[model samples]
Target chain A: MSTVKITEEQLQLVEKLGLVFEGPGLQPAAARVAALLVVSDTLELTFDDIREILNLSKSATSNAINLLLNVHRIEYITKPGDRKRYFRSNLARWKNVMKEKFMDLEKTNSVLKEVVDQRTPATKEFNQSLEEMVSLMRFMNQQIPRLFKEWEKSKS
Target chain B: MSTVKITEEQLQLVEKLGLVFEGPGLQPAAARVAALLVVSDTLELTFDDIREILNLSKSATSNAINLLLNVHRIEYITKPGDRKRYFRSNLARWKNVMKEKFMDLEKTNSVLKEVVDQRTPATKEFNQSLEEMVSLMRFMNQQIPRLFKEWEKSKS
Candidate 1:
């Protein structure tokens, strides 16, 4: 049995950090699980460890775990000797998550451009604004790669 | 009565753009309303016009419009001699909405910093990654203003 005791401070940290993830579209329970994984001293927690620590019901924990795993936010590894699966936050993947979001914007921008194209020239002012918005999204998408490159350079 | 006839293409535009807004946390109905306001040739819609065109229930349309207004995604204008207020997309404010979203991260980061401070030194590797994530967010926040400035210069 893994010998990790849940701390009150750690539990509070889960709740605090949980709300942050929730705002970005994560389910509340899943966000809390994500927070627990990221901020815990152990860095990895078994299924029961998370459920007991967070006081989540079996189904809630199961659903939350599945959701996180499916989203690539959390990942699991099996122990060499035991059949138990240990779950850990894919903290390293956060930057990739943000990048994927911008990549998703390309499809949306394409549709926005299409909307702009089909609109009657009578709505010239509105079309100009929409065009500006699309250009801004494109500008930011272009900037993200450069920005991350800048971050990597500065970090080294 | 204003003479804005609903078209099939416009309905599809709403569905397409609605999904885009839904991704970033807007409710489906509200997202549809936002899409309609932005893409429609008229640039604005009356409450009844929106309700009829979208086939949304009275309450659904009302709730959707209210949500958009509360978020500053849409605004109302009154004609000089008419009492009926006209609803229009505040498309220009979309960039501001994205900016406010990042601005919200400042508060989230403060709590994250606290989590880092309270963690045991033993979790050095995990702590380092969390610190990096925090620094990245801070870097992006700092970069956004300069990025926007560069966009303005390029636009002109």
Candidate 2:
């Protein structure tokens, strides 16, 4: 067992991020688990350790952690010589989440573009507006990978 | 009054986007209103016109429209010789929405960096993880305006 203590401010930040994570379709408990993991002293915690700190029931903790793991937002590894599993935030996978979102945006943009293309030239103004949106989304998709590359360069 | 018709597919898209808008702090009615405006043939509709199409109560329409207007997600224009106001989606302002979200992400990154700094050197691995998130968000903030500019050029 690790001697980690969470401060009041840390707990408050965790609750706030818990809500932020909840915005992306995570359940309330799962979001809280993600938040707690992010704010934990070592940024990695065992199942029993998290449950004890969060005062969560075993079932609640299990369910929330499982959801997080399935989403690839969090991951676990077994410590050598120990039977316990340690979980931590999968920060590297956030780029994948951003890519997935932009892909969805691209899909929506294409659908909108198709809708615009089928319209008569008489609907010029509205078609132009829709076209602008498609252009914007396309620009974003083109640039996101470069942004990811920039981050990699910054780290090195 | 404009001769505008929404097709079944268009209406479905509007409904989907309405739910997406609802997730971003807009009330359900406001989100639906925003979605309808986006898919409208004229891209602009009068208050009475929208109320009729959406089958909303007068007060509900008023309340929802007011909320959207206050948030700068929608805007209205007055026609010459007309007392009636026409509302439309402020499509250009969506860039601002994306900017605001990135700013919030930057703030969260800063807070995490601060937390990482306070931890002991022994938590080097965890601090490095948090630093990478900060770097990624920082990179995004630097690139978003450039992306917006690229969209402008593409449109031209």
Could you give candidate 1's per-residue lDDT for residues B1-156 as a string of tens digits? 446876898789889989988988899999999999877888778998898888899899999999999999999998898777799999778889867755776877787888888888998888999899889878887998888889989999
* Candidate 2 clashes between residue pairs 3 or more apart in a chain or in different chains: none
Worst 10 residues of 1 chain A by lDDT: A1-10
| Deviating ranges (above 4 Å) for candidate 1 | none
Cα-based lDDT for every prediction: 0.86, 0.77
lDDT of 2 by residue, B21-56 (tens): 776567788988998887766667888888877778
Give the range where candidate 2 chain A is weakest over 10 consecutive residues by summed lDDT.
Answer: A111-120
Q: In order, what DockQ does each candidate have?
A: 0.76, 0.38
Docking category of candidate 1: medium
Tell me the tens digit of each residue's lDDT in model 2 across A16-134: 77877776578888988898888777767899888877778999999999989998989998978999899998877877876675566566566566556655577677677767777
Candidate 2 CA-lDDT value: 0.77
> Which lDDT value does model 1 have at B143?
92
